[model samples]
Target chain A: MNGRCVITVGDLGEFGIVARIAGRLPQGRTVLLGPGDDAALVDAPDGRVVVTTDLLLENRHFRLDWSSAYDIGRKAAAQNLADVVAMGAVPTGVVVGLGLPATTAAGWLDDLADGFRDECDLVGASVVGGDTTRCDLVVIGVTALGDLGGRAPVTRSGARPGDVVAVAGRLGHAAAGLALLQAGRAGGAGPGDPAPAELETLVDAHRRPRPPYPCGVQAAELGATAMLDVSDGLLQDLGHIAEAGGVGVALDLSAFTVPEELETAARLLGADPLDWVLTGGEDHALAATFPGGVRLPPAWTEIGRVTEGEGVEAGDRTSEHRGWDHFRT
Target chain B: MNGRCVITVGDLGEFGIVARIAGRLPQGRTVLLGPGDDAALVDAPDGRVVVTTDLLLENRHFRLDWSSAYDIGRKAAAQNLADVVAMGAVPTGVVVGLGLPATTAAGWLDDLADGFRDECDLVGASVVGGDTTRCDLVVIGVTALGDLGGRAPVTRSGARPGDVVAVAGRLGHAAAGLALLQAGRAGGAGPGDPAPAELETLVDAHRRPRPPYPCGVQAAELGATAMLDVSDGLLQDLGHIAEAGGVGVALDLSAFTVPEELETAARLLGADPLDWVLTGGEDHALAATFPGGVRLPPAWTEIGRVTEGEGVEAGDRTSEHRGWDHFRT
Candidate 1:
């Protein structure tokens, strides 16, 4: 950290970071060319398209001390790709915009960019266009574009009563991870690491989210009635689907199971894994509703059912589930 | 300047922002109704597209004291759209990623949204999509999509000897405005209403760029040998066209004229107006070469002609000029 650098972006340099970051991209067979070109071109199928954008700022969304630049990049790309998939579309290309202070090291930017490329690789997408400039802090604005491949998009408003509400990804992990990190930072849990023996994986989950991309596309392919990315947490996100689809949902938490790693971590923080599962965010999981026994994708699991109500119910208690609010003080 | 915090986003938040922004958009006449949905659909002719992005950070690119959120929004959209026009394409739609402190007023965000809408309105393009998240400082990322509409892109690599070099708009005022603001902040500029007499106009140019959108599209339609936006400066940007086109240009600036506001500001600063004309940037004016009478648009005025030379020449003098390099020491 103390290697070199007079502050100011002039000191940190521009093209140098681009060069380092460009080296890490997979240039997946689909990528015609990565960076360095004035523009990047990706394969767009001969049909309609889907495009979405999301912006992430360091310190606001994540801390450098808590997450590597790579994790941040990957998480950013994952969230955007999840949106396209939620629309029943296959992501084809991405354009990233990065803003950083001149005091930032060349390596840090490179690592952050590498994170983006690796995440794009995970989602089977390619980097197309990007622009970088100096800023007071690190900011990433990613735009994900996709091709529909002639399939009609399944929007959030398509769910109907009697539809089975299902989720196809992990829950409670990121929240548990965040709780552990915060606990550790605050000297709440014993010591050593912030998370008790059980929860470090949860902390990892918070830093590096894993969205179920394939499950989303498959759900769409299999005629998902309504689909949404569980970025704001399960109960909260499901509430969105309920409202959008104009239906109510009751989640069977007793039927909901958590990975042992996440459960262990929740226990260390003296918290409920159920609460984490119900309210943790940044997981980028997909939650959808179907009419019947729709052929489930391997990565997805059944969780509950959509009914004729207004809110979400977990077992005995009904949860209002407000969703993640970024601007809350 | 203090106002009411009438809205709590958590109660109505991200979804609220989307609904409000999308509601004010011009979605009927020229734009289709895919705005608030998952993605937007723009009518792209020729089945080809040109795209570009740029990121602007507060403090690095602008000061809150000098610019309103609306101005920043317009500037961001203008810059990206200029790149599309540079490729001889018509802007179809725009997407934005905004990052700012959560505590900031929602109305300011609305003003920023207004700015984006106003700029896009100029080109009959709609604000198709965008994303917002919290950040320590304001960061704006804009991506502009355009349609070639059946014609090939007039690139920087098409100029040739004997091509008449012509410019479609004014050169450099934003840089001068920046200098005025810096001078005012340091108490270097004379005390008056705005420090510099033409400061208002210069500041206006910096805040909301007036790119010659129609002229560029028309120039391409008229078969421009090569085309580009004067983003860096007249001389520096033209140098790109020269180097890429494999032909040199002789800019007869002995017969040069500039906007009166720039002249007034230059005189007040005791600086040469020609310097601004030659190497100042951020005006986003169009520059192109022609093979014949160059079916010029009504707004275009021919300033110079391309010649078989080594570098650009202002009158008889060689322009070995370097424009303002933001990353330079």
Candidate 2:
């Protein structure tokens, strides 16, 4: 017989588990109705709502051994919330659909809910409602909603020639962290040999991405043209802006200030740091374009210039990598 | 070599598949910005929006051999849409996150999209945006958004002791259909012997639930005190209202008009017809409580009454079954 008195989800039943999760979450001001209802009611003050959805499956999107349940929860919420902000809207609430194996521990789910609540709190949003079901593996589906605040949506097609391209959050940090973790898993390091503080920071970045939530609204208020979350690599995501707007984006690679940790990790791993910055995905940075002559705020860094052509180029070389494609890549 | 060339999602790629699906879906009036952007912008004419989510796994929630992809898509959208209407709101749009195996045929996805579109078209809603990813099994997450149209939401906690309970739409049909399918799978029936029309109707009900979409609004407009969609068994869902309102629900077994198909199926299988009507789930029938003096419309059938105590009772006996629990049952 097992000595530990661990409770599984099957033991608690659906309603019991839902009650535990709901009891812990604090409702936001915009939530008219929270959990324990047929549906949640969220305030859409501006008469329009921006919506986005994402799916993360176990092993494909994340591994349980590599990231904790809390980490997965944060990452899942972060990615969808980033999408809402990318539309130049203020996020109001999120509804999640979680499918987990019946054998999953009850504590693991509680930690997951805590991660969702904490991450939502960072942006003044809340977990308004969700549905949980039994499945063979852990699959998370998050849909985030936001209010546009009476402003015209900044879409990808609005970018044009003579615009300046910029970004508002970290790049390559998650990728470098991922590399470190992969190497560590390959017998490079164990619990006995702790990673350096800087390297550990990278690993943490991969585990839970902290997107610049307010920067999206700020960019729109500043009259930014096209915008999107840099979920794909820098060059490939820029290519979307170019393709949508019928223009070209030329990047100046020298403008990027590679963090010391990325450089050091790259040196040790025999990899190109520039590649991580240019082609890595999952950082969820805000990439946008503005009129060429506009004085940009400090939060955004100019990375490239829009040109009268097609596709994306970086420092006289055309990029071939198009970032992550779930099926093909 | 294979006899026929089949285009899988892996061969078509993510962008290609998205473009194909997007090309097929026509934008609704409420969609300010449709797919191909970071997020979709939906017009919420009222100040509040109703949202709900549900997850459907391949084997657990449905079996591919028993139901078509189109049937699964309709069922997924219907369940969430029903939740919205249960709150007295009209569904505006839906965002889906789908995880499919790399080997899934492109045509199957197209049919699924068609089903979603057709179902949305029924209620003047549309598929605004979605995310697709690769997984070992097919998992679908659907989040539906609705506009309350300035009406106060009808919650489950509003039932009073003197209130009368009523139901709208089909009940026990889906459950009866499921039992038939399970029997057929266990070698009871084959293609050589076609099922009667009534049995086929039950099977179809299980595959695609026909939730009375407009009845929810009708009930609210007619002054429903408490309401919920019966996705779980009638007794189980009524128990939720009873518990929430701090009152007991006493259902009359004689009040129900069991469909002939249910009776025929029950007779053939040696099962109780009353059990199907009382405990069957997934029909998405709307159950509501109203003032005892009020006359319910023709769409609603009075079935029970609110009492001073807690829990649900049918005729003289209290219910023992608690319907479908994702983790436990």
Candidate 3:
């Protein structure tokens, strides 16, 4: 760190920066032509590709002051990869669009690329190609492509009455972490900080969401119908399925046993843990509705049932709006 | 326009804005499942997908004050589509990631979508999916997918000595138009305004580049050794070919006959038209090197030839740097 040249992106120039970024990426078998080309060729073995895009603005989607470049990269990759998983597909490759300030340190980009590569490696995917440009703020746009592997894509419009609604990963943790950070109680915590285990877990989840990626494919194999990643809170994301499928979802709150850690953390903050469970988003959890009487996959925990009508209900509380509205804030 | 709602994007919210934007796009045969789902399914018939991505930041790439939202959308689509074409493939679909201020007019997004659709229509492609987020400045990220139609991708490394260099689109027009805009001479010119016809043509070209999309496939069919779109000026872009092919490119100055209008416009501005022709970029013209004996396509004009050694030369004047460097500014 002391002897090496730490040049800025401006000093390296666009082509130079691109060359370095491309050099560090490990191209897998899927990449026929990698960077330094007009376009990249990736084998889509399934004959059809599942494509999804996500835009992450600097302060809106992430805050550099709170999260390191590595965390930001992981978060960006996780969210986009989860989108492909939600479609019941195997992740293939991702093309990224990165906008950085000219004065940004080149090492920051290196760490970001490592983050992308590491996250992609978790799903057996690869970073194929990307475009880099200059912007005042860091803007990351990821377009993830996936292969269905002969399975039908599970869309949000297939849930029906009598279907069991289930979730495959933790919820509300990210929101709780965000709350802790917003309150300035978590970001500065160090290795020996006296933060509770629950608070620490929530904060880490907020920084890097570990979505249950495999469960998406497993759910599809087990005949799950309507599906989506829990991005805009559980109830809010569930509402999308309800509205798309023209059905209602009535969640059994008792099925969700609030973790003792979360309860303690909630009590510490004087906030309702139930609200976080119902409305906290960005967990990247897979929520699906399966036909009743089918053997449930081990990864899934039944939490609700599809009902006749519209909107979502938790216990006796039914509402049409229970999610995050990006523009409202 | 009077009593009806003129809601901003903030008023409509993310889902509402997405619904409105998705409602207006014409999904073609390629899109199996379009925008309302977590991801879109587009057919990749050739079992391979040619992919590329680009980021366009406001002010850095396009200025909202100078171009309409519609024009901005068209420009973004054109650049990405040109990348696919440059790879010797036909475009299939595009997924856009748009970052906008919440206060942006909902109608602006509608026009942007229309512009995207209009440009896609020109290339027989569709808008498959997108993600939108709130940001201080408008940033557009487009990932374009293309089908190779069973042909090997034309890469930059295929150019060799004894190849005839040719181009299939206009040169220097966009740069000339940018100059006019920068001089504050074109935007305010009305129908009866005193702006020269040539200046108007340049400004229009700058606003919307019409790449010779088909010529890419045509060049591939003709067994051209190498091909790329002229994105960073003839000299600057050709340098990519030279570096990649391990060869030199020599341009014939006499081969270029400056358009009378461009010359007149250049004189009016006291600028040398030759400099614009030599250093201008973003015309998105197909630049290729065909075998010397191959019958030159009618769409292409012979401009130069591949030479031994390295770097590019034009009438004994040669420089490694002659194009836009994003970090330089």
Give me the candidate number with maximum DockQ. 2
True contacts kept of each: 0.41, 0.94, 0.91
Q: What DockQ score does model 3 reach against the true complex?
A: 0.85
How many clashing residue pairs, candidate 2? 0
Candidate achieving the largest lDDT: 2
lDDT (Cα, tens digit) per residue for candidate 2, span B149-172: 989999999999989999999999
Quote the lDDT for A67 in model 2: 91
Candidate number of the best TM-score: 2
Q: List all candidate RMSDs to the true structure.
A: 3.9, 2.0, 2.6
Report per-candidate TM-score of chain A alone: 0.89, 0.96, 0.95
Error of 1 at A163 (Å): 1.7
CAPRI docking class of candidate 1: acceptable
**TM-score of structure candidate 1:** 0.88
Q: Looking at candidate 2, what is the lDDT of residue B238? A: 95
- Alpha-carbon DockQ of candidate 1: 0.43
